[model samples]
Target: MKEIMKDLKELMMKIDKFNSQQLNMLVEHIFDISNEDDILHLIH
Candidate 1:
């Protein structure tokens, strides 16, 4: 769980550095498959 959270955080930070459209797509894709905890942990 911790490893997953760490990876998710890293992915989100990378996504943050993207241009708007790319970031939107990345987030959309992430939400499409991710569980509630994964998304919540990333956001918080």
Candidate 2:
């Protein structure tokens, strides 16, 4: 779990550094791959 958290933190920092184009693609990919729980968390 700590590893997951660490990786996710790294991912978020990387995401934060993305310019508009990369962030757009990332958002698109996230939507494409997200499961029900993931979608629920986002919306809620």
Candidate 3:
């Protein structure tokens, strides 16, 4: 789980460079697949 979080953080850092529209789409896709706990983790 820690390794996964680390990798996700790295990926998010890379994704931070994307423009707004791309980020929005990516976020929506992620949310669509993510569970409730994952969504809570993301928002916090």
Q: List the residue pairs that clash in candidate 3.
A: none
Query: Can you write out model 3's per-residue Cα lDDT over 9-32, one digit (the tens) per residue?
Result: 998887776667697887897779
Which candidate gets the maximum lDDT versus the true structure? 1
- Order the candidates by lDDT, highest first: 1, 3, 2
Candidate 2 or 1, higher lDDT: 1
lDDT of candidates 1 onward, in order: 0.83, 0.80, 0.81
Residue range 1-44, candidate 2, lDDT tens digits: 99999999999887787767787886787789659788667657
Residue 13 lDDT, candidate 3, scale 0-100: 81
Which prediction has more favorable TM-score, 1 or 3?
1
Worst 10 contiguous positions by lDDT, candidate 1? 33-42
CA RMSD for every model? 13.6, 11.0, 12.2
Candidate 3's C-alpha runs over 4 A off are 20-44
